[model samples]
Target chain A: MLNNKEYLNKLYQSDKPLIIYKTDKGYDIYTDFSRRIIINKKNLKYFLNIQTKSKKSKIEELNCYVGFFGYKLLCENIGIKFPKQRSKNFHSGVFYKPQTKISIGKKIIIKSIKPDFRNISINTKKYLQLNKKFNLNLSLKQYSKIFNDFSKNIKQGKTYQIKIAQTYSKKGNINSIDLFWKLMKMNESPESFLIREKDYNIVSCSPETLILKKDKTIRTKPIAGTLRKTKQLNKNKALTFFRRNEKETKEHNMIVDMERNDLSKICKTGSVKIDKLKKVEEYRDLFHYVTTIKGVIKNKMSNHDIISSLMPGGSVIGCPKISTIQLLNRKEKFDRNIYTGSFGIIHSNGDMRFNIMIRTLLNFKNDIELSVASGVILGSTAKKEYNENYIKAKSLLDLFN
Target chain B: MIYLIDHEDSFTYNLAHLLDSIEPTFVSNYYEIDQIKLEKSSTIVLSPGPGEPKDYPLTTKIYNKYKGKKKILGICLGFQQIVFCEGAKIVQQKNILHGYQSHIKVTNDKSIFKKNFNFLGGRYHSLKMAEPFVSQSMIITMRCVKTNVAMAVEDDINKVYGLQFHPDSFLTPHGKYLIKKILSR
Candidate 1:
């Protein structure tokens, strides 16, 4: 394990953002102004003094990373195909394309990132020590923005989820906001993140993959049923209705069927397995019907092929893939550049990880854009969709005005 | 120009309806720094969305980039974001609060000169902080109607500010004033 804090200190000390990223169950790479280090699932390879492209920013850049949990896969499967490797070069690994140069405007001095430490665990002691480096004081009032939008979108029938997440823990005392943002940017992983500390800014500027790798380990947690809080309400009945509601059950079944068929694409015949179905998990605001699908990839399938097969997750696109995508095409009035897309990175080794940029922000030069959308089903009402968008817009709306 | 952070059809249309007088621009959340050249025209707003601050770093970057150069307003996460961007901590709450009439108490009138705190109510369901804290330069302008948690905070911190409550929300009263007060500045 590397002292990520010390590494972060080094990046900060030099005022350069380092790019650190990893492939699932494989290798992790860290590129920066000083060095470009690659850490495989086993050995660590150092590639210093690498080549750079003619175009580059003269300023320093830093980015770092900590492994993301598998729960991340559920978010990306929103409107794309399920259980797919996001990056094209995962199997072959190692993508060193046109790099950026930090020049003084005269002689072009090329620079390449270095490779370092290989073995790292989600629960490593050294990782934990390094994780404490950048402790942020996070405000708690944003969830209401989610609720407000949820109410509005629900009324409009734009079906989407309101997920409130917190950094329960940081594995590597890695505290570089710039580094974390940059690492996910590498490979421009669609599900990767870049949140700035100075402005509490965040960006899903990933152009790579958005879901988990291998396409074998697949997941689908379709949401259904919601509880409207009222002064006069029956708790037990509400619980019973939520637990076994009819309408909710139908929505749940539709998604389950939708997911099963998707799994059949990458899985062997009869290999699709249901780990859990209709599991109701209660959150601060509402409840959701979560189902888990597990399957092994067919022996002769390439990750990219599987990726093309499942470009947009079904969660965002709706049940019947074609019809649902078409419905969204007609109903959705906004251009979803990367909001519903994905972003993540592929390392030298084949290990990969990614997420859905649902709660993503588009940062252009003069404009700071925040985007969010939801799935609209056949049973969805216009009011419901509107409320869902409202719920969805809670955080960004709060941040904007 | 009414600068909104969200790109919903009505977010533009309805905003246009509310101010049927102005042609507001509903911006999208996907751009590099050079794309968001939001230099002084009038109002700039950071909109709402899913995910936490860590997900959309660019919005914050853009805000800080134009902090002193423009008159800005943050709604929902945009609200919390401005405070956090100016150096406050954004932590998740235990119990999420949402819906209309979720207004807070305005302890001070630093940015906007408002009187009644009860009239400041807006529709919302969020997880907020206990102490309404801000950077030394910022002043806590308003709070939750009931909890009194910091609902709005601003200060001499580079003419930039934020509101935890929703002003564009159809539910809020005098949202037009709230938006204009910041934009007009």
Candidate 2:
């Protein structure tokens, strides 16, 4: 049970690149101080997409991945072209692909008591700094218009579902490290992790699981439906409400079907089945409907094939994933960066889990941003959908309160 | 006026069109049904909702209040609630059913729904009344073709009906027709 401050101090002090991925029941802390691989756009050539014939080493002893998959990276890799736009392409992912050779000195830490942990002494003066309020990137009207347009798209048979995202930002004289620590304390999620880079920092408590692989079994948990949790509402009542919400169920079922299709790509025929369907998973400030789809990997199917099949998790984008992504590329204003991206670890032993980058706070060039989105269906209304974003943001916003 | 209890289930919205088409004055919620209003209404329709029978204790109270006095039609969760109030126990199925479409074999449709009621029905329930939990006063009218689970129960003596499947959902082949038949009775 590492306190937030201590964890931040240790994170800043460590020279090695590391990743801390918290699971539903536990957390995994991985670090490789002696050897760390950084995957960037420049080195994109070194990487191979899924099922490439130029495949190099098929086995790696111990590989620890400590980065994310940008929404664009997945689109480009999957051969789905995005609409030309002025959006900036910030450094997206820093994946450490499974290497052929053995790396013996890697570090692995597992703690049961909320592993977004490390203990550190706090500076009282820094703690007393003024906190700034966050502001939405789009106003209610703009969000409404976008939501309405998405609903129209759904009606026109353009797409069955499309995830509409909005970013919240705040500027102030603040400490990003302290904010990261506070977020971890307030809204600790299954995929909770803090990534400290030379120029930027990411603090996340994401609730969505993107990709999980263990040996021949590979799975993806796509989260779709959402409802804000409040003190006035009883747990049973809330669960009932969420369960009967037709709009939410439709959104959730679509993604579950999409995830099943994705897994079927590299999975053995008749091996794919939904392990869990529409289970209401309650988080701190919000509750979500999540379904876990699992499939056995086909023989000789490399990790690349699995990632390609399921990169840019369906829940974050939408059904008919590629086309909706293209539509969003033309629509959304700001770059998603690592917001809709994924952060996880691919172990050397072939076990891995990545979290969809929602409920995540990232600081690049000292500017902090957090993102929240709702799945848009034909029945979705403009105001209601936009309001859903605030509900998603409430947990993180509660950190300030 | 048709009194429709709003259980806050999203599927309850589907009942709006069917109810409105039948009665000009439609009020939502069983609590809103007063003695005079309940007497005046054509029928009391319990809208489909979430949760098990016990989760909605109010529905049981309504069932007790107007058992034989008024026409009653319960759909989905409402159906489970009706049977539970009649001394029946609802048990969680080994495999929870949701958004599943299948045939419901009509064993005895001599009560309200038309004869030869064997038709495509859609179910979305995690709990069902199997052989043991069948209500003492209610008759099992229909069962799913696949799981053989109880799909419809009725107590014609009390003028009460329950359907495990949602007749209001588009998945049901004869949903509108079945709803009209139940209400017309």
Candidate 3:
């Protein structure tokens, strides 16, 4: 019997489409897929409908598809169309029907159509480190200009809050598994995940859960306020700061309301309520103000309705998701790719869990890119928000150092 | 039936769900005003949205067309539309309060809000109806206890009501109650 690390290495060397999703307890590794569903603009609705109509498998956990939905795909899903921006033209999203499944929690469990481990040897050294410097796509001057424009929009009541994205890119060969491990050591977020595909790889330490559905119950945790962690600042002090600061409280409130509104679209009336309000989540570099909202899913609501209402989550975009997205699409030069997209699993039983893809590194064709953004409200200053973006990207960028 | 004119706002669905709980509601974008059967609806609800009321001239037209015929209710930007149509200037608020909870004091007991009782409401707007309200028909019903900014207004004769704060928000505990009260009236 192989150990967990050895099993992961074997799967990684297989060069098959794979995903290692981190749950609250442990990791769920999916490999040896039978089919790959490449989602596009035309087939999105069809794909969603099919997934919704899938029959429950005899085995519960093994019957699932693990994949990601890109930012452009989610935007289009919600009926927001924009002119094509300069991008690497990554596939909108891809999902896999896995034949082999491994769950590494208190007990290691493996379920596969054919379990064959012969002729595969694990390397003593699991990963190689790389030293590459990342450069921001937008300079301070450019970001400031965009920030001022967004501020003007906020003042005009065009949007209450908007997130301005900035990308840090570097051309280099990256061992995604190696980088994922290193970043996890530094910042092990709850919604973290790693995907290794033939064409591309995604490593994320995303902290926000856009949607988590089980049967008729659905929940979302919207993270809004961010405070840089210091020697003197702890979770309690950070909570106090978030409570006293009018701007932070207000920003968090807007995100909570927006998320609740999204849930309200598919949730039964009077069932949408805040489970936990204004809680503090501590991370390596920052402390976030988060709120957990739960709702009872309305009868006959399909997976498409839930995904459309929640993807490109409001906490990452802004309040008034539609208008804010339009403003962002107009102002932003590059396609967001999968930055604010969602990554998770959809089970045959209609149970699903997805996380907003923030604090993620996209290593597509050896052009590694890490995108980060900060929420800019009326009281937000350019320099502060600009620096906040760097603080977000610092953990991922430090892996290259 | 309640006719909800969506302003491309995120909270429109929330308000729709709230209104639907009280009465069956039909929602349409403000641009699709011509397509909707406005006469079929007993109440016309203008949803909270981005931008000032001037950006939605069609909503104002609906208010003008159905002022006395049907009950008109507006929230956030919708509230500004009612004030804007009533000959009041919508200016930038001194303190922009988005998603901030404030205690509102009812100034007019004859309106939907109970008099002398303060209640928390969620505010999300950058613009406010300019002070010393010049409209004779529109009466300011509720004002923020701290800022004293106009939080709610109503026209009894025209059966039109507007609320600056979002009653659909969870922050506003009495959100459903307020909606039910307005719809019943």
Candidate 4:
């Protein structure tokens, strides 16, 4: 059998923390997993990531991804179900839609990560250890076996995902998720995830993504206001409080409008509709304003188009899109790179799913860079804005030092 | 007790510590602010945080109730909120300027900056106050150095005061002195 295992193993080598990945650069392939790295006998390939839409001619030639996307395609084509499945939007990066393909037999998946790649001036006093070294002597075969068994359990609903994510830090070492939990304790509805590309290097534990998706349809919910509920009040009072609350609604409505415009490019014009607005949702640790926007795809837009339009979700970007990006770009020194990019799965049929890249960490070889920020409105109190970001930052802070 | 009645704990805590008050607390999370009874407090301090004033209902209620009831002081966002409610205009900053190092001229020494003067305060701010309220008949104890960008206006007419600089911060040499004026009022 012309197996892709050998090629995948080639990409999952030891030594380097990250690898360059772009499976079929000529053709864009759908991949829910963001564990991408193109490894050869000697070198890792370069993949160009673009925020702008590619010309139709350019996109038509691209078909498959270099790393996990290709692995996912091969698995689906071969019907090899993963032995264990724990894919989350937080760490999976950004998947345009959701699709599953698993073979009964074993398969190979290649991944590369450069955990401690770039480092400038980090808040070393506040170090973040973000790596976990799995020293298990399990080979590709054994790992595959475990995955197979895990997939069987998932089929039984033994393992289900309530929240999904991928996170990073400056230091390549993390003691526990306790710090992440601490942030959650401060009223942060944390979304957690784990990933190391091929085998091992760095793993991510994230707490956010304003949206979740299912097939060609999608949803974008921006978190604006927060109120940790202690007791349930009467329905009418609760409704009145949520509706009457001035600050929360403005924060939410702006995001909804922003999301609607985002969905407009890939989704049908009128198809994009706010299914629900300003519904107070209570997750494990935090209560938030979760609004659902749903729309059917209009143009025969590819998954790339959808992801392109919604790269950094609106909740992170703020109200005015271009201005916010430019404003932050001017102030913030470090490059965002993949730090804010999302991860998820792309169905073979073209549907995909992904989440916002909040509560993230970027590991530095000798140190770590974990950061969190809150959106600032015109009348925002300087102290309040700082505290909001600080609360969001707590998830990763308590983890390292 | 002094409640930094806004979020952004790091910044507020830093300012609160500088004030060196008997009791200082951070209250940006509305839930925390709501649960705590404000009846026993001697002074109410509204710290800074994200979002414009019109959105914060709690702050509005607090503003309406306080109405300079207790010795009140507002910083950055708090300043704008209290001033606007007390009837004043807040103009949008045409260009955002965020960083430290002051470019303002404090001409008045009566209101908040009573004693110390002729100084530069470290500041990182994005917004500005336009045409602040200052009493015409009586001495309002306020000054505007827009030619220098930093302006402080006192509606002594309404017993309300606003600080363009973080007076409760050590970044400004006379910051503590300015805050003392409000606290001891």
Ranking by TM-score: 3, 2, 4, 1
DockQ of each: 0.01, 0.02, 0.81, 0.01
Candidate 2 clashing pairs, residues 3+ apart or interchain: A6-A118, A6-A119, A6-A120, A7-A118, A63-A348
Which runs of model 1 end up more than 4 angstroms from their true locations?
A1-192, A195-241, A281-287, A331-333, A347-351, A378-380, A399-401, B1-185
lDDT at position A312, candidate 4: 59
Ranking 3 against 4 by DockQ, winner:
3
Q: Per-residue lDDT tens digits of candidate 2, residues B17-66?
A: 54555554354554454667666776777866545677777778877888
TM-score of each: 0.39, 0.60, 0.95, 0.41
Model 4 reaches an interface RMSD of 21.2
Identify the candidate with maximal DockQ: 3
Per-residue lDDT tens digits for candidate 3, residues B84-126, read 9988899997777888889988888777667977899998999
lDDT of 1 by residue, A1-401 (tens): 43544443443334233233333332233333233222221221121111221223332321212222112222233332223322112111112221332221233232334333222222221212333322211222433444354444433223222222211112222233443434333323323454322212234432223345443554433344455434454555555775565445444544554455455555554455567755554432333456666566677765444443344555555433443343334322333434444434433233334555454553322224445444333344444554555554343333322
Q: Can you write out model 4's per-residue Cα lDDT over A1-401, one digit (the tens) per residue? A: 22445422322222222222112111111223223433221121112223112232222212223222222221222222332332221222212211111111233332213232122121222333345421212333543443344333222212210011112333344322323334334434334432332222222344445445555677776666655444675444545676776555555655665566567555653466678766766544345667777777755776545654555565665533433343344333334434555544333344344545455543334434444555444334434544555555554554543
Q: Which portions of model 4 miss their true places by more than 4 Å?
A: A1-35, A38-172, A175-191, A197-215, A228-242, B1-185
TM-score of chain B of each: 0.79, 0.88, 0.96, 0.76
Error of 2 at B105 (Å): 13
Instruction: Choose 1 or 2, whichever is better by lDDT.
Output: 2
